[model samples]
Target: MHESLFSYINQNAASPLTSDEEALIMASFQPKKYRKKQYFLQEGDVCKYVGFIVKGAMRQYSVDDKGAEHIVNLFLENWWVSDRESAVMLTPSRYNIDTWEDTELLVATVADMVDLIGKIPLFGQMTRLMDQRSFIASQRRLNSTISNTADKRYEEFADNHPKFIQRFPQHIIASYLGITKDTLSRVRKQAMKK
Candidate 1:
């Protein structure tokens, strides 16, 4: 259960927190369950909490004026999900987050994060590192989308997340890849044949 979170924290965060600091952060965190199709954060709403998935899948997406959904990110077991724009700016979100499956999450409110940084400065360093890592990953994604071919995108995605290929449905994979379902099917077939 929380062993995953502990491992994640230990991996990303160095310099252990003081007992008081750890307790404060833990106090503000509460576990919540979301069912399939549930909306965690809708576009235009302020995101109040950052969540770590205990189990299940969630997608952060944007919808165009034409009512098309473009997946910006996908999170599954042991992943964190948040509307980064709103979280960083403390403003309404442009992304909508929803459960792609029944999900269990450990949620830490924004207030707690502020307090954590104030009490445990090392946590701040940990957070900065995580943010930088996320930025680099996003930049790589943009590069892949713009500079790489569609087949390359599929190959890269598969290489990065073999578990996702087996866990997520094909349609969702297509959404994450910025491709049509049919194209994803073909690309996957070609990749497997090779």
Candidate 2:
């Protein structure tokens, strides 16, 4: 169950963890499971824990005044899911996070994570790398949404995240691309022809 987390840490950390470090890190997280459609977080609630997904998928989204959900992010195996702002600031989150399928997570509270960061040098390094990558990904997505054409966006997304295409629904993919479902259908059909 902790294999993926250890693998991620080993891949990202400046150095591999010692067995003692691994044991300490493992002790910090608690395993939990969520049924499909269960809430990890709700809008207006404070996000208390940052969860590392062990298996399955989750999504973070917000409902507009019109009551339509706009997905902001998706999570899968080896991904970390949380409203960082809410967790750090102890404020209500604007987004709702929920399981898309039966999901397993290893979760740690902000305090526990802070303690781990202080105690584990490699863990800190791994987390810093994760933060940097997350920021870069967010910037790229923002730029793509602003500058790319709908078709270009879908093509790029499909090429970059083929797993998402297989795992998520078309409507969710369309939302993530900031395009309408019909536009996504047209783009997909056009791609099929090409």
Candidate 3:
């Protein structure tokens, strides 16, 4: 479980972490399991844990005033998911995070993470890079949503998250892309013909 998570972090982090540091990170980590459709973070609740995915997929979303769901993200194996702002701020969350399937997560509390980061310099650098990537990706997604056609949005989304095309349900994927299921189907059909 730790292997895949650490491998992903090490590969993606700006500075590589040593084996000793990795071992230290594993020391304070706790494992948790979620049943299919279980909530990790719920709207109006505080998000206290940051998780590394060991198995299965999770979706981060929120319900609108009209009760339509908007998916913010899909996390799979080796992915990290949490209400970063809420967890860091210790405030109520506006988003909801839940399992798409039975999922196993390696959880580290914010306090534990703070301690680990202060002790491990590599961890801080790594987290900074990851946060930067997250910010950039969010901006790009926003741009895509506002400026591009639905088909273009789906096409680029498929290009970036190749695995999600197969991993997520079509309706869920369409929700994430801010389009109807029929639009997603047409976009996919058009994409395949290209």
Candidate 4:
């Protein structure tokens, strides 16, 4: 339940929250559910809400001109996901975020977030930390994409996420790695035989 979210908040918060503060913060969030493959945000639509996953998995991706899908990121339980640019600027999103499995989420509209920040300073601090971590992850992904070979990238991904290969479909992982499914298969096979 939402106690999971409170636990996550405690772990990331600048300091422990008072009961009143926790209640105020929690009031802004609404629980939502999506069936497997449901779209949370689709390309060309404005992102209306940012979600914290309570359970299940999701993927953020875009389809290229050639119709190939490129995964931007994968989100699992306890993770937060949003099309930040669209959410902040009120612009159409270029990416799509969809459920990979039936998902339960705690969602906050931008207005709710604004209210929470104004009412609870701890929420503001938590959001700042979230933003910083997101930026660092983006930088690391960019570096790996530009400087690493396919094999090296796969190795790093596999090393960092030892269980993802088992949890998600291979094609999804291949798309995330910026590699072809066949290439991923070959690399994994080679890795196994080593």
Q: Which stretches of candidate 2 lie over 4 Å from their true place?
A: none
Worst 10 residues of 1 by lDDT: 1-10
Once fitted onto the true fold, the runs of candidate 4 whose alpha carbons sit more than 4 angstroms away are: none
Per-residue lDDT of model 3, residues 1-194, tens digit only: 78876777778666677888888888867888999999988998988888999999999998999999999899998888899889888899999999998999999988888888798887777778788989999999999999999988988988899989888999999999999999999988998898
Q: Estimate TM-scores for all models.
A: 0.92, 0.97, 0.93, 0.95
- What lDDT does candidate 4 reach at residue 71? 95
The per-model lDDT (C-alpha) reads 0.84, 0.92, 0.88, 0.90
State which candidate has the highest TM-score: 2
In TM-score terms, candidate 1 sits at 0.92
> How many angstroms is residue 99 displaced in model 2 relative to the true structure, after the best TM-score fit?
0.7
Residue pairs with colliding backbones in model 3 are none
Ranking by lDDT: 2, 4, 3, 1
lDDT of 4 by residue, 72-96 (tens): 9998988998999999899999999
lDDT of 3: 0.88
Q: Where is model 4 poorest over a 10-residue stretch in terms of lDDT?
A: 158-167
